[model samples]
Target chain A: MTLSSISSLTLRKTPRISDAEFADLRGFIYDVTGIDIPERRQYLLENRLGARLAELNLKSFAEYSSYLRRSPSKDKELVYLCEKITTNETSFFRDSKQLDVFRDFVLKDVLESLQQDGRKELNIWSAGCSSGEEPYTLGIMLHEMLRMSIIGWRIRISANDISTAMLNKAKDGVYNQYSFKTTPQEMIEKYFTKEPGGFKIHPKVQRLVSFAALNLNDRMALKRVPKSQIIFCRNVIIYFDEEMKKKVINAFYDNLLPGGYLILGHSESIHKFSRVFKPIIKPGGMFYRKEG
Target chain B: MVLAKDIKGADGGVFLAAGTALDDAAIASIAALGAPFAYIKPNPAFTSPEKDLQRIESFVRYYFQYVDPDSPLFNELFRLVMERVFEASQKGWAIPCEYERQAKSVEHLHDLFFRDQGASLDLVKHETSLSSFPDTYFKIKELLDSPASTAADMAKVVSADVSLAAKLLRLVNSPFFGVAGRVDSISHAIALVGVSELATLALGISAIKFFKDIPPELMDMETFWKHSLRCAVFGKCVASLLPGLTSERFFTAGLLHDAGRLVMFKNLPYASVQAMLYARSSGAPLLEAEREILGFDHTEVAGLLLEEWNFPAELRSIIAYHHDPLLSPAPRDAAVIQLADILACGVEISSTGMYSLPGMTQEAWNLLGLKTYDIDKLIRLHDKYFQELTSVFF
Candidate 1:
């Protein structure tokens, strides 16, 4: 069935998710993706997945769940489910105060430590890098920091997200004007080339970062990422329940090099978690540093 | 009409100074120069809402006459919305840190509505957790409202809930009530805080507990409550300026005005974020973005929820029509809540995702009977009560 036909049918009578179906689907989602869908948020799942059901001509969430569990193309459908469940509310230069700390304090601290060890390369990981802005923003900042003599330093910004759709967009290296709301005009002029539909990152800055699809819940997949000096997992962990949050934070801790830094969203705190990292409060924002 | 501060060019040269009355040509030239925003001095002598509305209408007419000279309705709407925006500018309304790249078109609205139709219906039918007011609270309220009931009657209802009685005692003795001696009993606490004030406080506190389940990912509950409390303080302050309106009721009205937003977040977190992002990207009001994204705005949701909760009709109307007070049946009450909401945003209280302060309708401004100078006093009052109330509530 076409979208219009399905929509017209749906318009006649809205499909309702029964309490049993909601529980089944909610538990299924949590088990598969580790996203906690509380009882109150049943409407969100119904709304987002409702479109998929219509497209597939499925009758209810029960049918949709069965299709995922029994279909030959279950892997592809699972990706779609992940896309729907995960939120992608991110932009370039988000929470400027935190970015300032990343640039002024975290980067400075990392660079100083690296210089002492006679190292020239820097590795930064942007976990849950939705649509690429966070990592690219770091790329632009690094380019500016090293300006004329950047030839000597090797920079690697490894960006990852669970959603393939977001990863594709991030890899495309183009963003709309909304991404530049907090960005200064001069930075736009300096680092991005204006394309017809959106601003494209300068090739040089784009080259500094790499994008991949990785779910933080997958411990083995996380191990594939190199131990990094800085890890950014901002605004991502809030979706996970306490156990999942602990698991992911532990993975991040294990993957982080000694003296490495972990930056979370401004509102997020790991104070309740284990004290593997020392919390450092600075003017830019809060960051946790792994003890040596 | 007058410039409140200097407008500077890219090179730091002053284009216009403070206290410059912007003529037609000057306004045109400023717009032509591509200034994103500018602040104007408020008229000191304009006391009545009618006069202020007229002044604002004239200002809008003069300013947009060249740019959108043909559309009278558009001009009127602009003037109404810009009244509080311009007023807020004088007291420091900064340009929001974000803007939307494109306004949602009609086609996108259809797609969104079609997709979320089922979910929207479910939301409408979904009974909020706080549907039933606590029995003790209702009983106490009923006793307080009746002429036959005494302080002893009110105390009897409250003391039935031992924890509630203990809390009431602690609160009345707290610095908020400022009693000379410690109030050890419910009757004493009632006498100290007064029957109506104590009833209102109890109702407010009880209502607050229902919202504790709101996810931290959606919003900081503490910050959200603080903002609600501030709006309540501002609403009460605004009500005090008008005659024949109970200020305490307005305070509760303000407290519950954004209750629908909590419902939205609890049920529609994804869509709520989408609305927020749409608002941020487009630089439109959060309500407009919400309507476009979710097929209904928070005000409508709030109205439905409040109706379900069987709140007072006037209070319900105040919250339901707060965003568009001109359309409200209880216009004055709606206007008070609207202006209080604006003041809450203006004073840098918690925002409902959108950073920009919302504009007020001319009818709302007219209903409040406030002068520009009254704002300073209102802010002072808000500050005094906000501190004390936040301590008591939080």
Candidate 2:
């Protein structure tokens, strides 16, 4: 397979498609990573992956797909595909209603009881922390609350994403004022420092969060984070097929501590997954909790 | 480095950390640092809103006293106040103290506008020509608008400017026109050029000559002309789609919309550059960012220029609010100008054209009644027109 072959694949038809080529490509993606892409998405597949073909100087989709199959260097191709197709259109404190629910009901009740016990430490994970805004937002809220109350709480926020590129950016802890759009001006002036090129979270806020790359499909890799007090795996599982979603939710249930909170995106629910977790409806948000 | 500490609060409103107060005299020493926002935020000693205003005033006074004495910062600040005070002045409210400082700065800027003749001439030369052609433009517009006006009458109006008359002849004779014979006189040229093309060409020639004195920067001779010509070409292209909008008027509006930016560049170079840089870095659309960075945008500045120079009210309105077409009570001219500017900006020009403006507000788009596809098609049309014009102009 050559670069010219892939170039022809992009414009092979107007609003272009060749069903056989698309099927082979879909199967290739599924086989390479066990992620099934629907066949009707020929336009979606072609438009997104076509740019990669050009950049890699590959001529045809055939060669590109085969490159994923034949090369032992599949990691590079997998990373490229994930980064290209993933809709990382996340914003700070996205789905505000969900966060409010978590803050008021779940955190207030669960963590307050835990605080009375010996376990005062809180571990929260924002899985798929696209470009760092979500987890950083979580960190900011937690850091400010803990500092004001003098809680002496040991808080660790771990952010994980499948895209290494996005994880690196998350670790940078710099965002323009836009991401903090909903945040009040006084908060921005106080919590964030004007860094050399952009704004930075102060070291106190920075010390609380960590970023790592992880794939949700790997159940074994998911277990390494231990029992989390709250896991915000929002806006992630909706992309997966039913079986994948069930498997990921089961893994999340197993990973959370007893009475721990599992936050899904406003639209997502775990009802179909299993009987192990019960959905809790707070005033303004919803989350799944381990049923004891 | 200034320190930023979190004010411990449940609601996430932060303030300066305890024991982290900034010395006012010390800040007064280094207020002119490259980034002043840092120094301003973390100094709890400068806590109150009034104190912040005082700090800004001291910063400005010392910024002038110690730093660049003739800096345009004062003028820029003053212009901001005038715009605010103007609205307040209308309501019979006494100007705020901050506004008084701004008023004084504006007065200084006004003095500078005249005292700096070199700058003023650069500005004047870039507007309508000091020559007789401006008078000719009004006469020609009147002739074109009148139902009974003839090409001979149009030719008589333009013939008053010998240079314009000659250019009209040259245009009519150009191979692009496909005329078998040469145009001999103004009447022949106007007849051949057609009323629409004649008006477009006359405006173009007048604008080209007006910009002769100003030296170039991001907007040089080539850039200004290219942008103007592109707008003219795009205006014609887009106006072709709408009913009742004459293509020539669209072209005229396109060429004229950014004429205010040119005026500012000539008279207020520092303010203009700062505005341009802020827009580029922040990805705010040029006009909105200009309003923030310089207190007034090119559209407003151009409106003033057009009014002071006695341009038609329609043209002035078109220039003043091209970015916000819905603001215009009259949609035809404003819509034409708005669409033209968008098409011109969206089409990729040489040197990587302006960054994408943040999308227009939904209300504004709904008011214009244009969908995404209309904008896309308009951009594509302008891209085609720009290619055609580039080959001819370059």
DockQ of each: 0.02, 0.01
TM-score of each: 0.51, 0.42
Q: Rate the local accuracy (lDDT) of all candidates.
A: 0.70, 0.59
Docking class of 2: incorrect
**Candidate 1 deviant stretches above 4 angstroms:** A1-13, B1-394
* Two-chain DockQ for model 2: 0.01
Judging by lDDT against the true structure, name the best candidate: 1
C-alpha lDDT (0 to 100) for residue A280 of candidate 1: 85
Per-residue C-alpha lDDT of model 1 across residues B1-394, encoded as one tens digit per residue: 8887788877889988878889999897886575755777656885455554444333322222211122222233333334444455335643232221222211111111122333443564664543555677668667756899987888788888786776667656755345789788888878876777667666655666566455555567876777787788888888888888867677788788888888777666545665665455433457765665565788898888767655657778989999888898988889888878866765552123234345564446767777755666776777666776666666
What DockQ score does model 1 reach against the true complex?
0.02
Model 1 lDDT, residue B46, Cα: 54
Candidate 1 docking class:
incorrect
Candidate 2 Cα misplacement greater than 4 A, ranges: A1-18, A28-36, A148-151, A273-275, B1-394
- Residue pairs of candidate 1 with colliding backbone atoms: B49-B366, B99-B281, B100-B281, B100-B282
TM-score of 2: 0.42
